[model samples]
Target: MRIKYKMVLLILLPMLVVIGAIAAIVFVQEKQLAAQQTLVLEESLLESKRAEIMDYVSLARTSIDLLYSSGRNDEATKEQVKAILRTMNFGQDGYFFVYDTQGLCLVHPRQTELEGRQMWDKRDPTGFPVIQKLIEAAQQGGGFQRYLWIKPTSGKETDKLAYAVLLDRWGWMMGTGIYLDDVAAAKAKISQESDKRIHGVMRSLAVTAVLAILIVVACAVAVNLSEQRSADAKLTAMARRVVTSQEDERTRIARELHDGISQQLVSTKYQIELAQFQLPESDENRAAQQALEKGLDGLGDTIAEIRRISHDLRSSLLDNLGLPAALGQLANDVAAHTGLEVRVDVSRCQHKLPDTPAITLFRIAQEALTNIVKHAAARQVDLLLSSDRRSVALTITDDGRGFAPEAETYAQSGGIGLRNMRERAELEGGSLHIVSQPGHTVLLATLPLSEAG
Candidate 1:
């Protein structure tokens, strides 16, 4: 993938992970909270149901207060009280029942077949003794009990809550009950609504996370496009500079040949013509012989100068024997021309370089040496070439009166040469660097071996 896409992913992946974690935590916490709220609502509804049943039982007891408070223990009075209770029911599935202390059914408005049945051992589906528990609560004044019983309306076993009071004079337990199915329905509705809200929140979070990732991606793509344009501009400028540098080099060589070599050839040709004129009067003319010898010497010097210029244009050693021999020959030529001590070291380099990098290194070395000869006035110079499996490096160091590399004057004076050398290395996917102080200067160029043919 391109760098921009990679960067976008780098930003987006972590955000997605964090957002997903937050969503999960929120989902879990919301579910727990909904469960808790449902429990609280169910308890509240049960409490209301308990109070309502207690009120109904109190009203039934008050209706028989006049007869029971007269201290009567007659069976007729108990029968009259049972008749009133059988008719005092509030709604469908709501009523009161009576059981004697000996567990005999007396008043059961909902199921009249059990009016005189013995019911002491009656147990609910979960092994709870329903009549025994109600009697126990009534014996201890008044209290409540919870058990399952068949509902008249639905004819199905369901949870029920009852309040019971003891009628000591009649030797009976009387109580009323309310089923809890409404409270369960209410709790289930609340839970379903809570789940809907939670789902809505999760969807919103997902949309927000997607928008955030898209924004990051768009920004990365914009920055990448901008950088690409800038890089293309720089490449164009560098290409132009390279063309200009090549033209300038050709111009310099042409000027040297015209101004220096052309004048010497004219001088040598005139001396040869003068020697030919004196050769006709030979034997006694030592001056004519000396003139001929002088002409021959000048011709020899002219030929040597032409060969030096040709070598400068392109080194035969570089093409034939490789970079090491080329660099050694360059050092020897520089030392001979300038009387400066120059040493070439390739002892630590065994890897051979391909043409592009080899030529780049040679050109940078040539430029650095020319700069050193022209500006650096001290004694000795060293040219070191080293290589490893991955890359090759050429370092040129001089013990000379160095100038500040960053100074405006220094950069302006030799900026073209320095830039040319740097550009050459960069063109080969390499780099050039220079460091200079008062008595030391170093120019190092490095190129990758991976680009080699």
Candidate 2:
């Protein structure tokens, strides 16, 4: 992928992971909290139901208090109490029941057919002994028990909550119960509402994540556009600088030829004419022979000067002997001209670089040496070249009064030479780095050689 897309993924992947984790955490926590809330609400409602049933049982007991407190254990008095309880009921599915200590049904207001039947082994759908547990609760003083029973209104087995008490003298267990399908219905409603709320929260989180991703993508696009524009501008400027530098170099070479070599050639021509004029007399005159020799010597010096200028324009050594030799000759020339200590060290390179990379490194070295001569006030310069299988590197070090590598002038002012060197390295898929302290400066350039072969 392109760098911008890679950058977007780099930013977005982590964000997506974190968002997903947070959403999962929120969902799990909310679900747990909802379950807990439902449990608390169910307990509260069941407690209220227990209280209501207990109050009903209390009222029934109050109604029979006079009879029971009369110290009568006779069948007629028991029959009268049963008649009163059988008629006292709160709702369609609410009624009283009575059983003996042996688990024999005595009074069942809702199901009269169940009266006078043995109920000791009667079990609910879940195998709970309904009559046995209710009789036990009555025997052990008044208490509540939960079981399934036939609801009077629906005539279906439904959950029921009951309170039971013992009439000890009568040997009877009296109880009343309320059907509890409403509690189950209430819990189902709560669960349904909780699910709806959770879905709303999840939707909100999903929307937020999408919006966040969109915002990040938009920002990345904006940054990419801005960087592209800036890079284009810099490339244009660098192109202009390159053209200007080329023109300036041509102009300088032209002027040098005009002012130095052209004048010397003219002088040599005049001397040759003088030698010709004196040549006819050379067999008879020693001065004529001397003039001819002087002219030839002058011609030789002019040829050497021309060769030097040609070498400066484009080194023949670089084309014929490769980069190492060219750099060594350059070092020699610089040291000879500037009277500065210049050293060149080249390691045995196993890989030969292609022309562009070789020339780029050479030019970088040339620029670095020029900078050291003009600005660094250096006494000694070292050029080191080494290569591996993958890349070639050139490092130039100077023992000099070094300037700040981070100085703005190198980018903003008359520092095109440094910029040109860096641009050259980069154009060849390489890089240039400079490090400088008070009395030491180093310029390093590296170019990859993988594509050279």
Q: Which candidate number maximizes TM-score?
A: 2
RMSD of each: 49.7, 47.7
- Give all TM-scores, in the order shown: 0.46, 0.48
What's the alpha carbon RMSD for model 2? 47.7
Q: lDDT values of the candidates? A: 0.79, 0.78
| Cα lDDT tens digits for candidate 1, 299-414 | 65655766577567667677688899999999999999999899999997898778667767877778788888899996899999999888999999999999876675665566
lDDT of 1 at 370: 82
lDDT of 2 by residue, 75-149 (tens): 899899999999998877788899999999999988999999999999999999998898889889888899899
- Which pairs clash inside model 2? none
